[model samples]
Target: MQAQARGRKARRWIIFGTIAFGAVFLVVGLVLAGQSVSLLNDAERARGTVVGLEWRKDHSSSSRRNRSDDRPAAYPVVEFTPAEGTPTRFRSSTGANPPSYEVGERVEVLYHADSPEDAQINGFASLWLLPLVFGGLGLLTSGIATVVALVTRRRSRPRRSLRTTGP
Candidate 1:
C-alpha cells in the first residue's frame, strides 16, 4: 500500500509538472505569435544592411557540454538604422553563438514606423519559428499526459458486483 501511495504521488507530480510546462509554453507561444503578426501588419517597413555582426559565445551549462570538442561558436547581432533615423539591433542567437555576420554585412530588417524600437533583424526572422516549435511540443506533451492520466485512473478503478455471492 505504501508503494502504491508513492506511485500515485509520483504520477500526480508528473501531471502537475507537465501542466505547468505546457501552460508556460502556450503563453510564450501566444505572445510571440502576436508580435509576429504586429510586425507583419506595420506598413512602414524597410530593408537594412547587416552593418555589423555582434559575436558572443554562451557559456551556460547546456552549452558547455555541446562545446566539448568544437571551438566556441560566435553569435551574430545585426545592427541597422532605419530611414526614420532610429538605431536598432537584434542578436541572431537570442543567447547562443552570435551569428558570424561580419561588420558591414547586409541583412534586411523589419521595423514599425511609429515605434522604430519595435524592430528585428531579419537575420533572426525565425523568431516565430521558435514559439511555434515550443508551443507545439507543450501542447503535445499536455495532451499525452492528460490521456495517460485518464487511462491510468480508469484502469485503476475496481469494478465489482455485490450480487455475486458464490464465493
Candidate 2:
C-alpha cells in the first residue's frame, strides 16, 4: 500500500510539473501570437532596404555563469520611406551570428499605421518565431503529460476478474 501510495504521489508530481511547464510556455506563446496577430491586422506594408548592419559585442566574461562570453551579434539596419512621411531608419531587434541581411537588399516590412518606428521584418521566421516555438513546445509537453497520466492511471486501475461456474 505504501509503495502504491508513493507511485501515485510521484505520478501526481510528474503531472503537476508537466502541466506547469506547459502552461508557462503556452501563455508566453499566446501572448506573442496575439501581438503578431494584432500587428498583422493594423500594420502597413512597405518596401525597405537593408542600409547597414549593427554589430553588438557581448560584454559578459568567460565565467561559468556566462555562456555567451565573446560572441558578437549583428542586426540589420533598414530604411523605409512611408507614403506620406520622410524616410525613416530603424534597427531590427533580432540579431544573428552570421548576420541575416545584406546591405542594399530590399525586403518587405510591416510597420504600425500610426507609429512607423514600431516595425518588423514581415515573414514567418521573423514575426512568428517566438509564437511558433513556444506554442509548439507547450503543445508537445502537454501531449506527453496526457499520455503519461493516462498510462499511469491504466496501470493503477484494478482489473476485472471473470469466474466460470462448475461445469
TM-score winner: 2
Q: What is candidate 1's CA lDDT for residue 2?
A: 95
Runs in model 1 lying further than 4 Å from the true structure:
2-6, 62-66, 69-74, 77-81, 86-106, 114-118, 123-125, 160-167
The residue pairs found clashing in candidate 2 are: none
Give the Å shift of residue 155 in candidate 2.
Answer: 0.5
TM-score of 1: 0.69
Candidate 2 residue lDDT tens string, 20-55: 898789889999999999888878899999999999
Cα lDDT tens digits for candidate 1, 47-102? 65655444454456675667556445555556677786766776554433444456
Clashes of each: 11, 0
List the global CA lDDT of all models. Answer: 0.67, 0.85
